[model samples]
Target: MGKNTWIALFAVVSTLGACAQNDIRPTVRISPPIAPESTAMAEATVTMPPSGYLDYCMRNPAECPSSARDATHPEPMTPLRWAELDRVNTMVNASVRYVTDASLYSRQEYWTYPNGRGDCEDYVLAKRKMLLDRGWRAETLLIGVALDLEGLRHAVLIAATDKGDFVLDNQLEQVVAWQETGYTWEKRQTAANPNIWVALTGDAAAPEPFEAPATQPILVANAHGAESKPEVGTAAPAHTIRQDAEHAESTPALFASTTDAILTIPTPKPRPLLTARPVSADTFSLSYTTETPVIDTAERGGAINGAS
Candidate 1:
């Protein structure tokens, strides 16, 4: 081969070798995706109160009670005197008339001491005010929301006493323990800081059992092919059916035989051939005939052949 030809062949081979090396290079790999950690732990650590109450607090900053703001001051955790608690609860409940914020202030939500009439939250605020006036620490008294027996949202004043947490409700005449109200505890203001609130854990009380709905009993056919009417009101127990069966056994044998005869009578078999045949395009006739017997006036008292 000529010198230029050999040089051209060598360059082509070098290019091919370089291309092969590039094609044989190792590929870059990517790691598989990983699932994110759960947020339940975060939710457990940080909690908040109801959105409605928080929004009200933010909008009516001026209406925030002075006691709530000064809740941070150290106070003795002394057991609340029962007589004092009862007095304060009853006095505040009677002093305020129940009215809604919309009806009283022409606003959606407002928290303040009621002059004469106010809503549930208003009653709570008024009770807190009275208790504070009576030298009770602000932290001991809190405003909370709970689901009433009807599952409706309700607000009440919770007084933290050494005996237990007692609720002062405007709907009730007297104070009651928090657990006895059958209310679902949602959230409450912190004892350490009235301005802050925390989520309540654990089930409250189960709702009361409701009476079973009334139902109409289905009509059933007896052995004699007659429908039996059931008595109205609550259903009879299983034992009642046994008693009825026993009572039926004491019935007359003739009636029992009649019932058995009615039940045991086999249904008449269908005719082997149809007795009806078409006679004309517009009408048809039955092959069998039913004859009526003639009666004379003198023989009217005589017995008929098919009479039972």
Candidate 2:
């Protein structure tokens, strides 16, 4: 049996200078869940980093170009250079495939045990480092993200580019055009010092089990052999899109069922399923249709909790 390693830490490290004073640390649970992760795209010359990307300013202050006055260094050397980065992205994707098990860290801090690679956040770290070395802006690009009404800890790259804001996610490889990632997002900064993302939502979660595609009744033959419409409620495939330059948050429902014994098909009333697109090395996205008609609820309430 796998040993359960747990730490109940009751200390929060959020206080910047406060860490110096009232050192009341938050009691944090050590066994964290699988983190939601992302990636970036072909756009380049990250010089002048996109707006609000400064939080990840520089891995090492000395190595980064001091001051934007000589800002042009961050710009992509050429349009073709983006292509070169694409080729280099193979490592990030390979790293994702290397480690299939969930690890207990985010971005660069996550563990890649026994010389293997994986864990959602780790994918983001590898991609970011590659982009930076390729001359992408240090301050202009950061792992940016926001949670929804449901408190799942989803992460995305906030690329401050001359073109505009873009999101990079591990769910797909195509760079998203920011506005197109679909989720209602709020601006956020990455916690890279020790390598973590600070929660934008204090303690609220989006909702349980991210939304699944709407179900159209499935038709099955009843035991009696007569053709009957058994109210077989089945969901459609979650959609995907490579549009834009952002990494999209992906839920399990987004992918088609992998079961080998079953043959699943869509309903006659088909809704559009966006094509899956790739970005950087560790991200992907596909747009899915929710129950278009809003769902009604009972008077009694439902339970909610944080996803991280």
Candidate 3:
């Protein structure tokens, strides 16, 4: 071959090598993901804990175990875990009676697990304790406070899971996603530390403490001229009992309080478990009913349940 022809061929080979290294294909940028990168709620500035929380912590030290660091991550959701959540939520809701602190303890706010009769705060306390006892992580099971649809302050147990945050509420029987609860979430205990809470709202200040409505002593009416006394273990009248979706008359037994002398008490009946049909080992349909009440009471304040 001619020398000039050989030089031209070498130049062509050099150009091909440069083109290969440059990767002349058109640059295509992938569109950013539309779905959120994380389902976990966005936490805001750290704020003061709710009223009566400190006192309650004083009474029960085990619940507020860590204040310094993040102890555990959000729980990974599973069919068995979902069933446990539903069981505890439904059980506590049905087993506890809603009464104001003034009516029961004669105080504005009191936080304790409901035994037979108590108010909203008591109900929440019961659910949290039960879940913790079931070996659930303390950091994942957070106490959330929000303004209800009625602008009443309400409390719900927020279970932070890999899927999302779920609310275990006393007012509603179904376990629902936090965003669907119709509550303006104000604050919740931080996942890093159980004792330290962070505001969901942008502000860092703590919300105003809740004050219970003043309740008058309930008096019983009698048709006859003779005084009437309630039997030791009888249920309240049908009219006063709140009917369920089935319109069935199911309520707790009414009992007279020695201090307040209130005779018209409606006790809670044990509610049935949510239908837990497993879709797979890791996933499950937690939806129980379509007729579930959507409104969660924001009454009183944090630590208070939906009923009172």
Alpha-carbon shift of residue 60 in model 2 (angstroms):
9.8
How does each model score on TM-score?
0.44, 0.34, 0.52
lDDT of 1 by residue, 210-295 (tens): 12113211111122212122223323332101112221212222112111111111112111110112222222222211111111
Candidate 2's TM-score reads 0.34
Q: Could you arrange the candidates by TM-score from highest to lowest? A: 3, 1, 2
Whose TM-score is greatest here? Answer: 3
Looking at candidate 3, what is the lDDT of residue 59?
31
Distance from true location, Cα of 265 in model 2, Å: 60
Between candidates 2 and 3, name the one with more favorable TM-score: 3
Candidate 2: tens digits of C-alpha lDDT, residues 20-78: 11111232423112211222222211111211122111111122222122212223324
Give the Cα-based TM-score of candidate 3 against the true structure: 0.52
RMSD of 2: 23.6
lDDT per residue, candidate 3, 1-308, as tens digits? Answer: 11111111100000000000111123243322221122456677665455445334323333443223333456777777788887887777666666666666555555556657665556676777778778887777788777766566777788877777777776666677776666777787776655456778523222221121122112111111111222333333321211122311122333211121111232232111122112322222222221211212112111212111
